[model samples]
Target: MNAKTRRLVAASLVAVTATAVLAGCGSADRGGSGAQGGVLKLWTHNAGNAAEYDVVEKVVNDFNASQTTYKVEIEAFPQGAYNDAVVASSSSKKLPCILDVDGPNVPNWAWGGYLAPLELKGGEVPLDDQLPSTVGKYRDEVYAFGFYDVALTMFARKSVLDEHGIRVPTPDRPWTRAEFSAALADLKAGGKFEYPLEMGTGGSGEWWPYAYSPQLQSFGGDLVDRSSYKTAEGALNGPTARDWAKWFRSLVTDGYMAQKSGSSPNDDFLNGKSAIEWDGSWDAAKNVEKLGDDLLILPPVDFGQGPKIGGASWQWAMSSNCAQPEGARAFLEFTRKTAYFLEFAKATGTIPATDAAAAKIPGYEPGGRYEPLVRAARDFAVVRPVTPAYPYIASVFEKTAKDIVAGADPDAALDEAVKQIDANLKLNDFYAD
Candidate 1:
């Protein structure tokens, strides 16, 4: 779809889905489950991803086999359509007993009463060992748990950086802002590659905020002030944020990176068109296969505050209207096995949610290759703001960031964003409980 179409659809979804989740919830019958001692339905967004789907399917099948009193069923949708499907299901009160949602949206969903606090029976899956990003929480209660998470990191060929005299950075000592700029400048001046950096800029939707807002945070600005989660105000439109905007645009205008990277930044980097690529752990396996020992999965640049990256991917939750909350919780707890975490991490090329799961995977073991990504996630990862206003905030940030990257005045764009965000928060009474 074109940019305009995508924006329109996203906005419409935000409105329609928000209404569906808030209005007339708890009015649906059965929520697609048995009234008592009956089958429990589970929905997932992994139908299009066979590996993850298989892992989910196995978990469901195993749960069904393990208990005679309750049998869990699976219905899957493509990731792109899953949210819309849930919204429609919710409007009709056909939501499954359990459903998986994006981690960042858990707060919104829970706040809208679409999800219930995950009460795992028998403590089947202890959450203490899992990464903080894998446990989705709001109002001091966990609403969702995820299998794995992806870390945002920089990638380059060790040989190329070595030849360029660029020092490979570590989690403890990442490239400072000046050093990163100098490295990019050197790569651009070398002229071996036209775009010294490929940042997957052609992507849209959550990618814009999820991939870039952390850079803004590293510059000592956040999507919103976490202290109250009330307004963007000085947070998004502040001086540090403006610096982030100007520096980001400079990456494109100064010719260090593509304004719109090719459809695949990883491919561009692999093909030698880009010296360095900023991407997720999902793409690291491919680069490793191609570059072998020369592949460098380096830490993000420390833009003053510290290196930061977005966290929280997809997570599973129990529907608030589930007819059998106990059964739903049991099913959710069943899926949190260490084996499943390992399977998911291996299949999806993401970091394991728990250290035990990480130990099971090669290169994910401590002090091994790719462990820096795990460290980055554990150290520098920041979950998006926890509030019902987040979806709107994310959309605003996306638009403002895009405009700024396209040469719009950062201050003006950011001020407009803050105005809209404040208006929204006030409209919702600060999403009061």
Candidate 2:
């Protein structure tokens, strides 16, 4: 809650309750500490991530050198502390003109008046070429856009799968619910590894929902019903959701995985301690580098519903109270260049935001080794529930899922999750504010 994570339970409460304390959102002359009118300040949460920080620095340097109307100064903070800093700045009315936000938090920030809807003129950004999940939209209004997105997939060794007689899965024909279970069973029975799967069950905060909820969605359930965004109700406790929870728990009960995996699931997979490791694309390159052609980056499983991977990452947006709103928009527009996207994708080893940019990246180009990942991102990605209350809901779902996986009754766990979510929605007046 003290940190700036969108799935932070405490931060979610702050996001909803602290709106009154936030300075009013409008075109005000109260700007940042940068030089007067001609200077616009930009903030980033990449202080610890050298690769992404360098990419942000390169973009700002080029943008500043390319223009005279606005000089965008940078203030980079460590990711762990960045979100909290934004919240504190917003309350004191000292937010920078431009800032990057976690995609899931855009609705909360926008609805709370901390962010303004983006106003990119026609063709300013290649919105069409960008992956749908990279654009952060809330209530039908564009709020933020990222230069890249990360996809989730399973990492396996071809040798292990072949030894276990597990069929390799593709995006078009992913492992069904039964097939995936059988594969895990085969791996477990082979006795080559203590556990057949490693899914980073040790992860916390946002990772829980970002990694697990998509499986729930694939089972024809979600953290909440997107149609209303008001409550969990049938979405969390319904029959499909119950089935998903049972399967989720069965992974541990059936000896397919650890209730809490090792701190480094990727390393476990790389060491052959686990036959399959369900993880995000951010870890794919290192695994690929180590295993080379033996590494298998497989798509998510199809659980009655189509296969899915959670989408959306960090994205840029203008603060609602920016003083030089026009300058802010100008810098925002400048960031749309495909070249920046290419640089970002290269710098971070991530999937490019646009296909044009992806074509420029070495491994992500057409028919390249990483090409299936890009296709998987396009075909299977699903953004989390788009609502101001999403942060709260995500937190609740994380706890509920953990409880169920630890052997709590699925029905009781889901019912508790639904009750908590509905109570929060009612407390916030359904986030109508």
Candidate 3:
């Protein structure tokens, strides 16, 4: 966290009286020696494991070593602080040359004039192959470039499932809500697992939305009505959404998922305390590394209607205040065009954003534990809302899902979510009705 960011967040904390904590959000301005030759400063919020950092460092180092025209210096920061830091740095005229912004922040930053349009004359970032949903539009103009691909998938311990006599769902097959309920009940009856499901609670703001997003889709509900950009008047709280909330709530009320635990949901599954872990494709890599070939990945659960698969594309963007914008664009283009993205995919244990990278990287093998995850990622991937106010909108759904799981009344929860979202939409100047 930098001084400017701390000051801004402190002021916002006092004013809003809301949990908009973006503390420790900015990188400690690091740069390469001899800016006389034009150095490109890069700041990234993706703080993967230590090994992942090493891979990124190596890539940056390789880039610096390969070229002498301009040195690229990379700085890291926590994801929580990224947007705040970027916003603060831009205000202070200390923004980095290359900025890696997330999906929701991309549009907001671009629209706010804090980021330079990648299509500018000197902007040479190739976004032709990127996902249209992630970085395609920004106030009717495109500014960011999507790089990495992340999709949701179901993860479970194969040993626990087999011990409980639970048949694993097929790679291409999705289980209806009834079949899914029975599996959890069977696991509970056999006493093989204390909880059949465990959703991570690292931060309710981020994890909770994902837990219910897939179900929302199956129920024929969406977070934001693409056409209207409002949930209260939209289908987000429709029958499909109601069913999802009720069913998910039952998992906690009926003692299927951890309700009051502070530890990670994945930790519970790894300890054999839970039968399944619904996580993103990123988890496939961690589980494979943690449990080796013993883990089983399954397609997301179907609501009898069908499962809703969601995914997002990661992007790398150059800031408007960057001194060496051309150099930063070169680096961005390199990461996307070269084998760097493929290396990133393999190292980070995620699917590549580009079709070319997907073809080059090692894929899940047949009969493997992750085959189902790979299949699910491919067949049913849905990206989140790409609107400028997406994070705020996602919060509406997250809070509602959390309340429902905690045994709150379904109708009351939906009604409250609708009310709160309407208030926020109005405050944020977005349309709610």
lDDT of each residue in 84-182, candidate 3, tens digit only: 666655556667777776665565565454567775443223455544544645656667765566667778777777777777876457677778888
Model 1 off-target regions past 4 Å?
1-31
- Model 2 misplaced regions, further than 4 Å: 1-30, 33-35, 122-124
Q: How does candidate 2 fare on TM-score?
A: 0.93
Candidate 2 lDDT score at position 392? 80
Score each candidate by Cα lDDT. 0.83, 0.83, 0.64
Clashes of each: 0, 0, 5
Across 1-433, the per-residue lDDT of candidate 1 in tens digits comes to: 3333323333343545444333333333343654646788788888779988888888888888888888887777767667766765554456788889899888877776677898675544588788999999999898998989999999999889988999999888999999999999999889898989888888898999999999999999989988998889999989999899899999989998777778867888898989889999988888889999989999999999999999999998988778888888777777778888988898888999998889879999998888988898899899999887788899898888888878898889999999999998876667776
How much lDDT does candidate 3 score? 0.64
Worst window of 10 by summed lDDT in candidate 1 = 1-10
Model 3: worst 10 consecutive residues (lDDT sum): 10-19
* Candidate 2 structure quality by residue, lDDT tens digits, 1-433: 2223322333444343433423422222245733376888788888888988998988889889997878888877767766766776665467788899998888888776678888787444567779999999988899999999999998889988887788999888999998998998888888787788998999998999999999999999999988888889999899999999999999999988899987778888888898888898888889989999999989999999999999999999988778778888888888898888988898888999899889888888998888878988899999988888877887888899889988999999999999999998887667774
Better of 1 and 3 by lDDT: 1
Stronger candidate by TM-score (1 vs 3)? 1
Clashing pairs for model 1 are none
